[model samples]
Every structure is written in structure tokens, then in C-alpha cells.
Target: MANPSHDRDPGLVLGFERTVGDEVQAVARSAGLVVDVVLWMLRRGGWSVGIGCGAVDEPMPASPREAAGPAFVLAREAVEAAKSRQRMVPLAVRGSDEGAALDAEAVLMLVAATGARRSAAGWEAVDAVEEAGGTRQEDVAARLGISQQAVSQRLRTALYDETRAATRAATHLLTTAHP
Candidate 1:
């Protein structure tokens, strides 16, 4: 059965589930930025994900008062839309009223591009850089014992810059909300 439960994005309070997929896709997109943060930390490397902003319902107990809300409904609809269109990621945006909204279609395209284009070596390089806290590509190359140029090429081929930029924006949205 589906583990129907309302979960908050870890390290960032939001109504959403984290790591919505298993074993990390080459690219993925989540409707919530906080979910991206979790994905970034958990990804097997070279994987990229986008974040969507919106409201979502947490799974509630037997109490109807705590049931899921419109946000959850909207997110569900977004996922269904993506599936119908064979998009790479699920998207749901609550617009400015909720948070940093993203165009689901755009995110789907970017994510699909990453998944379709990433290579195994590229994934390893990207993962290493991220695990090291976005370290310099030169440093990553040295660690991987490859030419800096090679690392640069891998990152470029994987669309690492664009993917990281999106993830960073999503993270900023989550952090800025608290302080």
C-alpha cells in the first residue's frame, strides 16, 4: 500500500514527502524545494533534481480535522499531469503566495534533458563535487585523478551548472523563509 503520510521536508519545515523516488533517477524534479535538498543529499551522484513550490497536505490520522488539504490535491494533479505527458518530474506550484513557484513544464524539460544526457562518469563527478559542498572542479578532478578539463567537460555534459543553480535557488527559498 502507498505509505500515505504527511511528512515535512527535513531540515526545512514544509508539507511534503522527501525522496519521492527510489534509487535516484538520472534527473528528477520535486514540487517542493525542501524535497530537492533531501534529494541532493541522497542522490547517488551525477543526478539532478528541480524543486517546485506550493502547499501540500500531510497524511493525517483518523481525525478528519487533520486531513490533507488543497495543496496536496494540487500536487497530486500536477504529478498526474506529468505522467500523462510523460514528463520527467512531478510539479506543483502554489505561485508567489506559497513560495518560489516554478513552471512545471520548464522544469520537466530541464529534468528530462539531464536524465537523457547524463553519463556514468559525469554522475560520479557531479556527486563528488556536491558531496564536498560544491567544491572547485579542479579540486574534484584532482581527487578523481583526472584532468581539470575532463571534470569541466563532464560537468558541462551533465548540465551540472544549470541543475545546481536551480537546486540552490530552491534551497535559498527554504532557508530564507526561516530567518
Candidate 2:
């Protein structure tokens, strides 16, 4: 949804349901999609995101306009929390008896660091490294027809290593999470 106050800024709202004792591997898989979407949105300069996971009291309406439920409430709360913290994304997950809220601070920092249009080339350089299946920097440089030193500079400029580490941590938490 586009922010009402600022037409240029957009917000994303996501919700899902989970059962007790349900493994979060699927959630982890979905996080990859989230990561991609966040990256794409951030590149375009609007990355306000909110995610909610819980059971809804009301049935889903044919149109989203009529949708109202606990999940929606949680999502709104998450968005508010993000706004309060000046963070890009916030996630709230509710299980049968447990709930968790996370600020996604690390990923937001990574996004903020690379949000400028000037960083697009560095993002492409990072993508090249990732697409090569974590190949050596020299290999990435060769493939991109750039000097290794140039590739290194781009990687550093993009905070590639720190971003990768943060992503890994997110995946780990999601995969091992109880809720």
C-alpha cells in the first residue's frame, strides 16, 4: 500500500497462519522471497514493510478492502512499531500460545546503506558474486570483466559480507524458530 501522507512512499503488508509445532522451514523459504522483495523495493527507495503471522478470527473477504482480523491488527501493530523505530521492516508472528516481534534491524541497515542509485552497480556486483554460487572474488571479477580490486571495492561499498552474514542469521533464526 502507498503511504497516504506521502504518495511516493509505499508500504507492504503481509500475513499468514501457522499451527502449533509446525516447523518454520517453509517460513524460512518464504523469507527468501521477502528478502528479494525488500531488496527490490529498497532499490527503488521505498521499503516500509510489515509482516504478521497468526490466525484470523474472521473469514477472508473476496476483496481485501473487507478483510479485518487479528492478523491484520498484528500487521498494523508491526508497521507502527517499525515506524516508531524508524526501521524499514518489522515482523510479528503469533502461534497458539506464543508471539514474537522482530525489528529486522540488520537487514534494514544493509538496505539503507545501499539504497542510493549510485549503489546500483555495486548491487549488481554483489549479485554476480551470489549468482556464481559464492565463488571467489577473482572469479566474479573475471566474469564481470572487472579488476579484482574493483570487485573488492564494490563488495565493500555494498557491505556484501556483512549483508550475507545478516541474511544467514535471519535464515537460521527462521529455520530454528518455534513460532
Per-residue error for 142 in candidate 1, Å, reads 2.5
For each candidate in turn, the TM-score is: 0.56, 0.57
Q: Where in model 2 is the C-alpha error above 4 Å?
A: 1-29, 56-69, 80-100, 103-107, 114-118, 173-178
Q: Record all residue pairs in model 1 with backbone atoms less than 3 Å apart, i.e. clashing.
A: 6-58, 6-59, 31-52, 46-123
Among these predictions, the greatest TM-score belongs to: 2
Question: Where does candidate 2 clash, by residue pair?
Answer: none
lDDT of 1 by residue, 57-173 (tens): 455333322445554444445444544553334333333334334443354345545645678898888777867786888898899999999999988888887876765555555
lDDT (Cα, 0-100) at 87 in candidate 2? 40
List the candidate 1 regions with Cα displacement exceeding 4 Å. Answer: 1-9, 12-32, 35-66, 88-105, 168-179
> Which ten-residue region of model 2 has the weakest summed lDDT?
1-10
CA lDDT for candidate 2: 0.50
